[model samples]
Target: MKKMIFVLVYAITTLTIFSFGKAAENEQLSIALSGQYARKMTDASKKLEELDTAVKKTLLFNESDGSSKAREDIWRLSSDIKNSVSSLPLDQSFSTSWMNYLGRLGNYAKEADRVTDHNEYLRVMGQASKNLRAMADEWEVATTGMVSGKLAISDWTNRLDATKSGHDWSGMGTTVKQYTESDFPLTASESDSMKKKELRNMPDSEVTREEAVERFKKLFPSVSNEIIGVETSKSGSPYPFYHIRFAENQSIGYIDILEKGGHVLSFLSERPFGKEVLPFEDIQKKAEKFLADAEYKDLVYEEARENNTAWHMVYVRVEPRYGAKVFSDTIHLKVAKDIGSIVGLDASEYIRKENTHPQPITKKDWKKFFHANVQVVKEELAYVENERLEQRLVHYLTVTIDEHGVIGTYAVIIDTETSEVIKTERLQ
Candidate 1:
């Protein structure tokens, strides 16, 4: 019996030892496979890093003797990196940011290859570098987490700063900043006012349509010589303007003013394909009728005009109804040209229903959509002309949404007498 008991104990010990050994072997196999996969991924990443550096160098400096080859190589490297990274387990933040940066870089490289405008190409490349730095930071964080190792934040930060310094040294960032400062100086409100003044004061011409076409050719060399037709006279203005159309892909239409010393008054581009066309007046009538038919009892039309691309814009105000919340709301209608119909309408502030709660939304409502820490920086009022029966009272307000972000300006037009909103236009 003693011998039998000893044998049973020995058998149990041997089985236990065999099970433990098998588990150890499986773990070792997994570790080996993981290491091999990691090495392969690291090699691909190294190649991508090298390609990225070469592309940046070529873009920053006008280096030749294989710059085109480098550009093509970078595009292929980015694509390969995308495919490889997709197979790896990347979190949303890292995957999204890296893919976006790669896409932007690829686009920049393509543009650089075709671009004759050196300055524009440099500006695009500088932006690409900024985006890349952001992606690299995200990548470092993700890699550290995946390896379960602590990474030095300063290391990543310093690398990004160094890359930015290289861009600065090449004068790429400065060139882009200078170009932007010079090209886009005026505010949207100022631009709109200038366009309106130019249109209103355009002189009428007694010159024949043929003479008008010749004058237009001399004025605008960019547009091809193609006369679609001409309108002798229009109701809104006393002077006659020629309606000239161009080739399909070129500008859609242009108004050649014979009265305004034979100058091309305005040009319009084709709308996104398959859009209808509607006249300016017809759009205004439709908006007014829509508000009138609704419960908005006091619908007032403040301004209506034809914008670029032959789109008509109508600004109107709807007074608050009793037992309905909201003091007033502004409405804008975008009308299509092919048919006298409303293509788009924005009436966010003007929703009114009879059975709804009766108090107007206050500061709390505004806070829901706007940040609490917004700083009001500047304000300006539109010019007031007492002689004109139809006048606009516009308030230009500039505010900063966050502590460090672009200053946003908004144009708030109000009816002075009723304190009703006429229109709200966002400007950057």
Candidate 2:
């Protein structure tokens, strides 16, 4: 009886020890996985930053050297992201979805690198950037449990499909939005007919294609090569235009000339003078010069694109010098890059006259007009217009309050020329 009792006691003690050891081992494994995940994320973020810097340099300089550097940077970043994602443990709950998103991003970067045409490259890159930003946002939400990680993967793939589908390459504006949304991908006969219509409606002063080319050559002696292309509207509208791409060695530029009666509506080039190619800094300077006399405050440069027609969409605060204050009376200037001239400025938002001056008494004003704890995080300016020709320059200011509260945003617009308060609205 004593021997049996001793054996039973020993067995119980050994089993207890084995259970504790197994639990400790499992906890260590979990900790290691978390650390690995964090490292991979950090590496991915660093690579992304590098890729962005390279892209900005290429767009701003438009130099062969910059382009080459950007290409290499993109390739390296893609490879690193891919490898980092692959290194993640297969048992990770989010691993499969994250891997899919990274793969799609890699495909976009690869496609962008293959594009030799400057305009095409810009268009592709723009689309890719949008997709990347979306993916990043989705990832954040998924990790925070605001959205499902699996859903994020599906959404990214859908966006990729939307971007990769090719439509008509020719027509006005090499922008993907313009082409994909239009009745582009038209038949050859349809394209020819559209050309005929353009020629018929053109004014007599318009020069022929050959004549325009001759004039352009005289103006830009360095133009070693030229390619002609046509642009069609997405809705099959009668608005179609011809484009000319100029090249000097590895440097390239573009000019958009209306085909209607062959008039040169706009001449643009992405290439900058001297050693610089596409100098965004210079572009910003030009924009600033153009807005010097305007009464607007908080002037901002945003949404610049270098496509067949290098264009910059600038958003500035419109503080009216006199009259009622409107917050977001924005001005949209379409600048011609070839000549560095403003081709069009749309300020239709100011046409709808509104007096935004605070009334003597308002119910909301009495309840603390401003939140003291809120801190501004981000602000964006844009142009908004109504049918009554009333244009409002809009300023969107986002703020973060206490950790428990949602972010708040304020939208304000002002007059275009005379900076005056037009209106202010808040959102949370």
Candidate 3:
């Protein structure tokens, strides 16, 4: 009996260790894969910009003196864009239409190039340009929204298929206009179209594609290359922005500039980080300068995490009187380790601001509601969204629960005005 008992205890201990080891490894893998996906998304957006620029250059460069070289650029760019899209992390089925459209565009480019008469070429490209621009707008809405919002891959792919136009790169047959012109035109799903229709009505701001490109140039003077093209946010977004990308030499980047007062929503770039390492404070200061230059006002640094490769800095907006941190209004910057050049930024949530609320008339001692074994760790004033998605002032508390032998950590939120328990979330 004693031998059997010993064997059971040993087996249990070994299994627990093995299981936890696997769990930890899985967690590390998940994080690594997530980062990889983000990097791929950044690259894909860069390709899109290149393709957009090539198409536009073809149409316009020929305007004044009719340069054939500009038209010739599209064949190569179209092929490159198709390859880039194919290389994305998504299943091939999800991106098949993208390739289909490029094939058509490539053919169109060749056809445009072969035409001998300048007027004939102009007339042909004029019609093609409108279709190309509209579809380009469609793609912008898809790819640019990812870099902002820290959007999930599943959510991104789901939206990609929504309200999409059908064959021959037709803008309609669905959303943009009448589909009567498209060969074998088909309808966009009704449900998807309505969702997009709803998003189209959401009030943000608007800028022409030209204006968006100019903003990109003014904001990042270091990048002398032509602006790829402007992409719009997904149709499902409440607040949309124009996404613009650029590449120069070994460097590639993209910026999300909002139409709402033309704010810089976010930007990400992949390039050789400088070899020189600066102090953490200096790196943070460099990030701060970038934010200021982007016209992001009323922000204060909150915290930071540093690794060998980069420093991830966070900033949040604080309410003046109560000094409650508005957690939703956040700005994040990832600066290459000590290089001080910002490699990533996500301030999409900060673009839309909510009016500050006045102090609540009622205040309560929230501690009385907890069990006797519950020990209050820390509490603070904060602005957090309640169940209804309405922003509310609350006393956000960190508390520990000791029930018999087991211990647990939790975040408890209490509404200041009504003293109602807003929500409870387990930390561990």
Each candidate's clash count: 12, 51, 3
lDDT of 2 by residue, 33-152 (tens): 555565565666666666556555556544345566576666677677768757743223244444444444444444454346777556656655664554444334323311222223
C-alpha TM-score for every candidate: 0.31, 0.31, 0.46
lDDT of each: 0.49, 0.48, 0.67
What is the Å distance of residue 389 in model 3 from its true position?
1.4
Can you rank all candidates by lDDT, best first? 3, 1, 2
Winner by lDDT: 3
Candidate 2: regions farther than 4 A off: 89-116, 144-428
Per-residue accuracy of model 3 over 1-428 as CA lDDT, tens digit each: 99999999999999999999999988677556656666666665666566667666666654534645655666676677677677765434435655666655665566564446767656655665566666566655555545563655555556545554222223322332331234213223333333332333435557776777777777666763656766898887665778787787666889887765566677888787666778987988898898888777778887898877788899988878788888778889988884677778887677655555776746555567787778879888988776444578888888998767788899989888877688899985
TM-score between model 2 and native:
0.31
Model 1, position 249: C-alpha lDDT score? 45
lDDT winner between 1 and 2, please give it: 1
RMSD of 2: 23.2
- By lDDT, is 2 or 3 better? 3
**TM-score ranking, best first:** 3, 2, 1
As a whole number from 0 to 100, the lDDT of residue 395 in candidate 3 is: 87
Q: Which stretches of candidate 1 lie over 4 Å from their true place?
A: 1-11, 61-66, 144-428
The C-alpha local distance difference test score for the whole of candidate 2 amounts to 0.48
**Predictions: Cα RMSD each:** 28.5, 23.2, 24.0
